[model samples]
Target: MLTKRIIPCLDIKNGRTVKGVNFVDLRDAGDPVVLAKQYAELGADELVFLDIAATLENRKTMHKMVLQVAEQVNIPFTVGGGISSVEDVDALLHCGADKVSINSSAVKRPDLINELSDKFGSQCIVVAIDAKQVEGEWLVHLAGGTIPTKINLFDWAIEVEQRGAGEILFTSMDHDGTKAGFANQALAKLSDIVNIPIIASGGAGTIQHFSDTFIEGKADAALAASVFHFGEIPIAELKKELKQQEIPVRI
Candidate 1:
């Protein structure tokens, strides 16, 4: 059986890890490097470090921060935010990022996905889509889920997969920070449309939410932030619960 993964995400702005409700009113959580090392030690399957201010601040991911965290953790780590060109992907890889996640950049230049996939291999390329429902239609949003895109979520997902994205990190803006549960309906539809691994993000509250995400939604992985960072859910215990529930997990 294929093991399901549990990933912890760090939304970094100004060098501090932050979390917010529905992607607003950001509050500081802690230092990214410190928190990242803790998560890795806690047995998180993977870690995502997103420079939430990178694009808006017109800067790349903090090289110093990423390098530090990469050195501190033994687990696989992915980095994102303001990754535009293949050169950007190369820089992050050189910084010890096992994978590079592209969002707004891929949406603006679709070919960048193919370019990175060709240069770094699909396993090193992750396409993260921040999407939200607008007027009853699930639309892809960009720039940290602040701008709406005309592209349909399902179609864009397929396009990225065709472009060789190894994984799709799908975060529903509506469910983001809500802690209600994942957007299973959308995630299920996306899983049917794309063959690449899908990491369901947002709306994760308990271990049961993780179970539903993979078993019912057909997601390859589940990603969360506050629940893990704030001691609400521990990865090892969560995996134990998932195993008891007959969910495929690394534990």
Candidate 2:
């Protein structure tokens, strides 16, 4: 069995790490470089640095900050936000991002997924889908979840996979920062439809929530923000507990 991964997400705005509930009312978490080093030292399987406002502000990811954070961590690092073209991915990769995640851009130009996958290889591409349940239908949202779209969540997941995306980072807009648990049903459905790994994000409150997403949701990895950022859950302890529960994880 493949080991389930525990990833810490650093949501960045104005070059600072921040967290919020349902993607609003942001608060400072810490410096992205500092947090990345801490998480890497704490045994995080991977680190995700998202320039959360890059797309909203109409700019590319901060390469200087990315290089700073990259310098401090030895683990696999993934960077996202305002990444649209081959040039963008190339730049981030040169900055030491092992994988580059594209969200709004992938939705706006579906071909971008294919192009990046072909140029950088599928293992280097992750397509992030931000969606929320509205009137019982899960619809995709764009630009940091500020704009709603008619795109159905599951349908888009399937398309991204077909377009050669290596993995899917699905963040439930309804569950983000709630700490109640992850949107496991949606995650499980995504796992069922796609062969690529699924990284579950949002609503990770407790250790049980992490286990639930992996076992019940059938996710390959679980990514959380506030829980990890606020010291609500330490990566080492979480992995120890998950190991006790017989979940495969690198300790």
What C-alpha lDDT do the candidate models reach, one value each?
0.86, 0.87
Model 2, 82-198: lDDT tens digits are 888899899889887899999999999999999999999999899999999989999999987889999999999999999999999999999986888999999999999999999
Q: Per model, how many backbone clashes are there? A: 0, 0
Give candidate 2 misplaced runs (Cα > 4 Å).
20-29, 55-61
lDDT, residue 52, model 1: 75
lDDT for model 2, on a 0 to 1 scale? 0.87
Write candidate 1's Cα lDDT for 171-202 as tens digits: 99999989999999999999888889999999
lDDT of 2 at 215: 94
Considering only N, C-alpha and C atoms within 3 Å, which residue pairs clash in candidate 1? none
